[model samples]
Structures are given as structure tokens and as C-alpha cells.
Target: MTVRPILETHSPSSDPSWWGAILLGAVFILAGLIVLGDVVAATVISAFIIGIVLLVAGASEVFQSFSAPHWRGFLLRLLVGLLYAVCGLMLVSNPAAASVALTLVFALALIASGVVRIVQAVEYWQWFGWLLLVSGIVGIAAGLVILSKWPVSGLWVLGLVVGIDLLLHGFWWITLGAGLRRDNRAITA
Candidate 1:
């Protein structure tokens, strides 16, 4: 008896469907276009849309939290949700200020995430921990650079960030779809 890996070894017959690849590619192209369009839009408008989304999400969370059976947890969640809702509403009230606020929030979040990642990397060096550390450093550096640029960076950063996100997501989707198609074919064969 021999032990085997969970993933099957690749073979020449294990080819992804052409149709699936084309479909995935089309979706990726669409996503890229949407992100590009969003980037071209004014930051204030983006901020306003974000504010509205936040407001809706917070309100829904608050309602769900309060409706829960556990009073203590409900109270805690409700309070947090209320705070978020209020902040979101404030942002929507003044889109200009909201954009600045969102930028600062993003900077802080990036810094915090970087610090957490660095700590985790120090604790666990295996399984892409080093990659996490490098990413954290890059994130912190980027946040600092954005902070230094202030309002100017805020105006242009949203589009660039969205573009990068869409690109990464599209790539991931294409890869996953291809892999799935390949696996499906392999199973059939």
C-alpha cells in the first residue's frame, strides 16, 4: 500500500474546457472595465456611495443584533452597529469630508493590519508567514506614503485601489474556473 496526496497528479489529458476559459476571460474583462470606470469617477461620489452602503449594512446589523435572543451580545452588537450607522450618515452628509475620513480610516486599517501580520509572522514562520510579513511591510509603507500625500492621494487612490483589486480578483477567478473545468474533465475521463 502506498500513501497518496489529496490532489491528483497533472496529466496531458487534464485540460480545462475552452468554453469555460473564454467565459472566465470575458467575466474578468467585464470586471476590469467596471473597476476602470469606478476609478475614473470622482472620489467624493465614491465616498458618498460607500457611505450609503455602510449606512445600510450597519442598520441591518443593528436590527439583527437587537433581534437576537442573547441580550448581552445583542446590546454590544447594537451599540457598535449604531456607532457605525451614525458615522456612515455623517460621511454621507458631507461627501468631501467623508472622502478624507475614509482615507484616514483606510490608512489606520492598513497600519493595524500590518502590525498584526508582522506579529503573526514572528510567531509562525511557516506556511507563507514570511510572505504575510512582506505584505504587511508593504501595506504599512503604502499607507505611510498615502498619508504623506494627504488629500492629493485620497483623490486618486480609490481608482487605483479598485483597479488593483479587480485585476487580482479577475485573475483569481480565471485561475479557479480553469482549474475547476480541468478537474471536471478529469473526473469524466
Candidate 2:
């Protein structure tokens, strides 16, 4: 049996992209730290940003609806666009409320996903089922914790999650950069 590299043809030699990854990792880590420092503010800001994005997406969809060839499709797209726009306006108008609502939705999603994963884990128990089980348990625990705190949790959970995500993402990028650098060295030598 033989194992093949996924990108056998691509060489890491002479590529300076690793440095960029490292730089990005550092920035992400810094941003994570900053967000963690003021989670409430971070949550509000994130909600506002999401609202703006939704608004833009809604506008784009509405514009595209005009190009739809059929009346049914046009009506569907227009309706979706209007929904998005309305939701975006609501979010923008009250980011704190939006954060609370979104947090509740997130908690529910986590619990539902955890339950689904647990069921799937039973089926896959013979092969890496333990990992899935652990993940599912963690998800359930996290959701429970968030729900226990409810509205209070909403203010900080999103920001804390974002910060943690950024930190992990930074670490991943840094590790990737280091690996690339090492591979480059090996290839050059």
C-alpha cells in the first residue's frame, strides 16, 4: 500500500506566503484578545455588521429578481429579498436585541445538532465514533450552559465564541505557516 501527497506537484520552495500566514495569525490573535476584552461591545458591533451585510445581500437579491425570466421566480426572489431587508433593518435598529435573538437561535441549533450527531455517532461507533460522541457531548454541554444563562448569556456568548474562534484560527494559520516554512526548508536543502 502506498500513500500519496494531496498536492504532489506543488512545491513549497521560494514561496513567501508562509510569512503572510504568520502575519495574519498574529493579527487575528490580537483582534481576538481585543474582542475578549469587551465582549458586549463586540457582540453589538458584530450584530450591526451582520445587519449591514444582510442589507447588502437583500439589495443584491432584489436587483437580481428583475432579471428572473419567470414571474414565479421573480416573486420568490423579491419576497426573500424583502424578508432579508426587513430582518436587516430590525437588526440594525436594535443590535442588542438581535444579539439576544440570534444567541437563542444558536443555542437551539447547537442542541439540535448535538442530538443529531449523537444519533449518527451510534451508527459510526465502530470507526471514530468516540470522537463524534465527545464532540456531540461537548456541543450539548455548551448549549445547555448558554441556555442556562439565557438573555444574560446572549450579551457575551457571541463575543466570547468569536474571540475563541479567532484565537483558534490564528493558531491554525500560524501552524500552517510553520509547516510550510519547514517544508520549504526541506525541499531547498
Best by lDDT: 2
Task: Kindly provide the TM-score of model 1 when superposed on the true structure, using C-alpha atoms.
Answer: 0.54
For model 2, residues 1-189, the per-residue Cα lDDT tens digits are 997763474566457677787798899889989999998899999889889999988988898898774667788899889889888988899999899988888778777877886887687564345545665676677778888899889888978866765675566566656667766332220
Weakest lDDT window of 10 consecutive positions for candidate 1: 180-189
**Candidate 2: stretches off by over 4 Å:** 1-13, 67-72, 105-144, 184-189
Error of 2 at 159 (Å): 1.0
Off by over 4 Å in 1: 1-4, 9-30, 38-42, 65-70, 73-75, 108-142, 168-189
Rate residue 151 of model 2 by lDDT.
85
Each model's C-alpha lDDT?
A: 0.65, 0.76
* TM value for model 2: 0.67
- Per-residue lDDT over 15-126 for candidate 1, one digit per residue giving the tens place of the 0 to 100 score: 4454465476567657667767766355677788888888998898899896784766887788788987987898789877667667777777777877886887566453
Q: Which pairs of residues clash in candidate 2, taking residues 3 or more apart in a chain or in different chains?
A: none
